[model samples]
Target chain A: MEKLCRYETDRVGYVMVLPYIIFFLIFVGYPLFFSFILVFHKWNIISPMKFAGLYNFNFLLHDPLFWKSLRNTLIFLIIHIPLQIIVALVIANILNQKIIARGFFRASFFLPVVISGVVITILWQQFYSFETGLFNTILSRIGMTKIPWLINTKFAMPSIAIMATWKNVGLYIVLFLAGLQAIPSSIYEAADVDGATARQKFFYITIPMLNPTMIMVLILSTLGGFSLFIEPYVMTGGGPINSTLSCVLYIYKQAFYFNHMGYAATLAFTVAFIIMIVVIIQRKLFETEVYA
Target chain B: MKRIIFYILLLIATLIFVYPFIWMTTASLRPEREISYLSPLSRNFSFGSYITVFKRIPIVRAFLNSLIVSSSITISVLIFSSMIGYALSRLKFKGRELIFMVILFTMMIPFQITLIPLYVLMVKLGWTDTYQALIVPGMISAFGILLFRQYFKAFPKSIIDAARVDGCSDFGILYRIIWPNSIPALVTVGIITFMNTWNNVLWPLVVIRKTSFMTMPQMVVLFTVGGQAEAQVGVQLASAMMLAIPIVIIYMIFQRHFIASMAHTGIKG
Candidate 1:
């Protein structure tokens, strides 16, 4: 009777979790396995599958557009991650002070974070417009020349980077604020007693204490940087000479637009692999600094 | 002097962060000729652009579709995740540890890696342009399950034991005894899941080809990019506002819970 009761409860437990497990299998598990298999075969929606062995990988290796997309993504990270950290840190430091209407200020900053990416992208696209954009209007009023923000290739990626920074900096500010608050006041007090200047205290105490949050921000920013799609898609369509084509967007176009299923899957796997490697390296670099 | 400078800087930062949205709303109310003006106080404040937006796209239908998809996904995630969470945390079941590990492993895999094959799978199932395509794949989140499992693990075991002694089944104990106490967790998961599903663009962009079935974000993107609303900057901004206003209102009311939940989940934006 004891064994039977135990089995009955076990069955109930399995039954309780059964729905999710099945959903996971159908949605996550099957796709994961199929993506791997897809890397070795060519099959558009209408066509039959043909085993294509290492051709997709070889083609990707030789594809200049793939390299360009990878390079563009790196350029985005190079600009965006540092800009995000600096801007977020400065804003967080300011907001951390005992200021009037601090809650109101924080909410105002975070308002953009809650808005959808597509909305932000569209809003900024108009602001970046050459003819009658807000930025150019302001520029011309100040006796400056009107520069095409999105239409110009040299300025397109950085313009997008600036908008992205504005859109996401608030989340990092919140993170940094939490980290700043968590640092005990006694440390600052001791530094004061030692006659440490504000700049000295910031460098020696504040920066060091913020190391962990900085690392987390770095990793998340890097991952987000890799996933750049909707911004360029809405703003530029990866154009003005394809200067803004990101890896994910390229994979998307290849699969849906160009109907190269095998190649797109291969590119997706490569990007995922690259993300893992980059995240591991980032952790090692920052984690060592934290420990030191 | 320093305090004065700080206040000045704060005001400027606030304006910089907030001015575009103010501009977007005002521009949407302006005529085409006046839409380019930076000032929010415009003489051409009218609903003409909004009317044009409504005529160009099925905004109401798209909004309803988004509502249905997000609500369905959120409800299912709450029910199924809580069930699995309770099972993992409270039950003495075989293979529980292994299952938990699998769920955690799934959380680490980026959705981009699974995009292609999942699209193919949906096509094979003939689910394209259907709500099932948009809603089914996201019915349960691994992160939601983990979050609830952590919450449920901390609940007192004595109460659950007493309920069992009173001839309560496990399901009854969960539905009756546990869920009421887990309201905070439910709200956190519910808000996060709802916002994500509501704002999700890429998946719906891939699956739903027809305009009638598009979610708010997807419709807004399509309409603004190259659709009939493209040339009309006022109409485009109006469409963008339509997507943003509802979320902004929700955030205003639930700002505290939203921030707390974000902090708990460690999700950025």
Candidate 2:
């Protein structure tokens, strides 16, 4: 509270922040450090750990369930990334237009995000019910038989994918809308004066202008797709098969269900490592491709 | 012809996007057995199933639990982080860059990485199954402080200096000079943190063992999966609707602020 050096203010600030800093160290830093140690030894936290060396990592690499979960995560990403981008871009573009009631349209577009994920997931679970779901009701009216959504392995991952995208795309929509608004209107007007068609203006002017936002959206969505936990956790419980078993769900099941803390830690580390590599690659890709 | 067709297609796309949510709402209102009847879009609805869900489950209590957890976390993070944010931005200090960098790095580490350790900490603290477990651990969010520092740095420094000259204490200057200028940033952090805490599932699932202690999302998960051997689809939808209605109402009130907040926060982070 008293003056010394600017350094003293830093000291005072650190003291002010001591509580949070300590909490982060104990909670966040401790877990992160121990998780690595966890990957090395086989323990359920109740039992004495047996040093497993690289066995956990080896087991994770060879484990069929882990591979399946990783594959499922990739499939979720493949579907989610494109769909989130396209839907957000289109909806943001429309909302950005000088059309009527922009606020209303934007609010409607973002409605899903404000709602709870558990609510959204359950809503979709009901929507996915084979016997009495909203999907089936609508399909039946469209002259189709009931589709086994969650139960059928073929449809489960995609079903989860669609629901996840719906619940999350609003966040991306807002991001893109901000980017859209930040683009100088003069660019669009310049294109118009140059006799650019509407589609050309969109392709030439809008797409190029939104590059940074697109990259951010891509990385965020990729992180999201990999961290896929709750939807599949609640809806299908990771499946009729392992069709929708995301890596996080697999780790959760291993740790909580099977009491394989060591194995689950390995799985989490593996996924986190993969996510880091993906982020790095995305940064590289965006850096080179943009402003070229 | 082509333009009309394009407009028609956009309308249809919008319907496809929205129709399931609309149907979910209707089915949630229908009698349980009537949920299977195929006229969700057209059918007249009743509030009976919603009443049934409320009658059958701990929906009201969970709603209150969620409100408390979300609001407490939001308010605490707003207040404390602003204090820290002001000091970090305005006050010169040693190791400031290191501290700032630590906050940035913490953002990059997904919260899941800390979940197990934090859980162990909670159990050891004997704070498990209590609101303290949820609220205290997250009170000084690095993300909020970082965002607020970015905001506060842009405020007029002369005003804070003037307040300091006029015999105001450091905290008083922060409260009187910079705090007013930073309301937008506070709202931004508040909405994001509130929504985040409200939707938090994995940590709460690990920490909270009792159904009586459940948040709305927790209860929604329970009501969906952990009922009598037979689950009623309509009731589950009803539970979701009840959990979501308050959020949607709030979103309607502050839609612009919500959008702006999320946008600036995301872009900054």
Candidate 3:
């Protein structure tokens, strides 16, 4: 009788999951398989696909623009990851205190996170304008020569990095704040009794305790860094000599603009592979920290 | 003295984060030539830019399209994910753990990898430029499934058992009992899904070629970047503000829940 009842429940479970399973198979499973097959074929949407084994990957390997985009993305990660950590950590530490109107501060900080990326990019485009932009205007008023923020290639990627950091630092702050709250008050009290200064307490107790959240922020931001698209797409159109062209934007242009579907698929897979490897390394590091 | 210094620093940081938004709003209201005046309190406030934005784009239609797409996605995710969550948590099923693992694994694969194939699939299905292309692929989210599953697992099983014992069917037990008690999870998933879908630009950009079918972000990006409104800075700012204000207002009303929901998801926007 128990066996029969178990069978009946199993049947019901499958029925309940049927819709989700079908949708997932159609949307996710099929596309995943198709994306892989696309890497082996050469076809624009206009013509029938012809098998071109390894040609797309071969082109990707030698493409200067491809290399440039990868380099640009790495530059983005280098600038973004550290800036995100320091700013988020400092602000989070501040908000963790008994500051006045803490809720208002938190909300204001996170305001941009809720806005559309396209909107934020456009707003910043105006700010990064060469002559009449707010930043340039402020510089001139302060007796400093105005600098071209977006037009000049030297400052373009860094300018984007700064805007992205401003847009997203609030999220890491919240994450860090949560991590900070999770640390027991007794630990801080013990540090106080030991006559530890504020700096010592932060480096010794707070940073050590918040290791897991820090790792999580690192992984998420690294993944986000790889998926950099909208900022460059809206801000510069990956231009001023493609200094700000991101890996994903490169893939987007290949497929949509240039109609090299196979090559685009190859680039997309390369990005996914790189992200997976990075995330795996980060996770391994996290595990080692936990074990150590 | 230290506390005063801290407060001053905090005030400066807050202004750095918030001043651009205030500037954007005020600039939108200013005359085109005075848009970059640096003072947010320009004397030449006008509705001219807004009028231009409305005239250029089918702003209302795009807004409605975004509404339809986002709400449809949110509602479907809520129902289907809850159902899957309930089944995975409550029911005795074969390959349950394997199925759950599959769902979790799918979340790791970035959407870019699937973009080309999915676009091709949409084209083959005659879905490009239609609402179906925008709506169908995103109807069920892996993240939503995981969230609901975690929430439902913590819920007391006794209520579901009682409903089952009282001759309720599986669907009935879920709707009548589990759902009523799962408001927090529903709201969290709903808000996150809604915001993501509403703010989604890249996929919609690929699929929706026509301006009439475009979502707000897609429309705004095209308008500015395509040089349609590039000459008029005020109009561009006004279009961006139009795209941003709704979500910002929603965030203000549900600020606490929004923060909680994002923190819970562990994914930063």
Candidate 4:
């Protein structure tokens, strides 16, 4: 009886996971493998794929637009990640206090996150409009000149980064809040016994203890930053000299607009490779620095 | 004094996040000329823009398309991922660990890596511009599968054993027994999948060329970029509000789940 039951269980298990196995192969596995094969072949949709030995990679090496998009993504991340961490941490810290209506406050911050990115982009684009925007209207009300938020090359990426942070910081806030709550109250009591200042307690006890959460926020932010597409695609169309072009957005254009499938595949692979390297470096730096 | 300051600071931060939606709502209601006005009280709001938006595009149809696509993706993910999760968590089958690792590896490879090939595959299969293109690739979320696996791992083994002793089939056990006790996990996965699909713009943008098939976000984006609402700023904002309203309503009802979902998965697409 036991042997028969074991055999039936095994069969049932295989049957259960069968659909996923097939689905993964067709949807994920094959495409992942096909992406590699596509890198060395030039094929427009209507034509037969022609072998182009390293030609796609060679073009990628010299692609100015690709380089610019990479730079823009980095700039966006540079602004976005730090701002996200600080703001989210601060808000999370505040919300951790026994404040009245904390739920309302947390929900308010997370409101933008749930709303579609396209809606936020359109709303912010209007707010960032130079002449007749709400931001500019308030600026003029205060007798200050309107700052061009989206159009100016210097401000465009930063503006989008700020909006993106506002849209996403709520998520990290919740993360940080969870990390904050998980800290044993005894630790704070010990610091209190030592006559530690609040600042000292925050830096010494809070920050170090939240290392894992910090690393999580960093990685999530990095991944989110790399996939920065919809905001720029809608807001500026990677516009005003491609100042806001993201790697994903650029790849979309190359593959879909221009039909450079091989080149686009190469760009996608390179970005994926860079992301992996960066994530690994981050894990190493964070893991070693805090532990050591 | 410090407490008052803290309250004030929190209020200001909340304002920064919450005020935009309020502004959008009011702006959409205002006439085009008054849209740039800072004060909602500065003008008599009207529904002219909303009327114009409805007249200008098949927004109702777009909403239905978004509903169909999102619900189909969500349901499929729920059903498929739960089954895989049950097998991987409970069943001691050969290659189970290997399959789990493969799913994990699939999660790491960014979606852009497969975007071009997937599009080409769709073209080859003549699935482009159809619901299949929008729905098929998203049918099985590896994240959802992992989430369910983690949830099921903690499920009581005694109950599962009892169910098997009672001659309940594996599928029957899953649907009748394991699932009834896993509402939180089901809601989390369902909401996350639905939200991601509903808000997705990139995939639909890649595949769906016909306006009739375009999802809400894609349609609204085109409505904005194609200069359809050009010179009618109020009308543009109205369209954006329509895109946001349904998701906002869902968020309002499932506010806790939204936060928990993100904190649980941390895999916002």
Winning model by DockQ: 3
Tens-place lDDT digits, model 4, residues A198-268: 99999998999889889998998888888999999988999878999999999999998899898899999
In Å, residue B153's CA in model 2 sits off its true spot by 0.5
Report the poorest 10 consecutive residues by lDDT, candidate 1 chain B.
B260-269
As for TM-score, the candidate ahead, 2 or 3, is 3
Cα RMSD of predicted structure 1: 2.0
What is the DockQ of the complex in model 1? 0.69
Off by over 4 Å in 4: A7-9, A288-292
In candidate 1, clashing pairs total 0
Clashing pairs for predicted structure model 1, backbone only: none
Q: DockQ values for all predictions?
A: 0.69, 0.51, 0.78, 0.76
**Which regions of candidate 2 are displaced past 4 Å?**
A1-11, A192-195, A288-292, B1-14, B17-19, B38-47, B267-269
Clash pairs of candidate 3?
Answer: none
Task: Write candidate 4's Cα lDDT for B1-269 as tens digits.
Answer: 98889788778879889888898899899878888887765448789999998999999999999999999999999999999999999988889999999999998887778888899889989998899999988989899899999999999999988887888888998999999999999999999999999999989999999989999999999999887887577888999999999999999999999898888777664
Interface RMSD of each: 1.8, 2.9, 1.3, 1.4
On lDDT, the candidate that comes out on top is 4
- lDDT of all the models against the reference? 0.88, 0.79, 0.88, 0.90
Sorted on DockQ, best first, the list reads: 3, 4, 1, 2
Write the residue-wise lDDT of candidate 3 on A149-175 in tens digits.
Answer: 889887889899889899888888999
Over 4 Å off, model 3? A1-8, A286-292
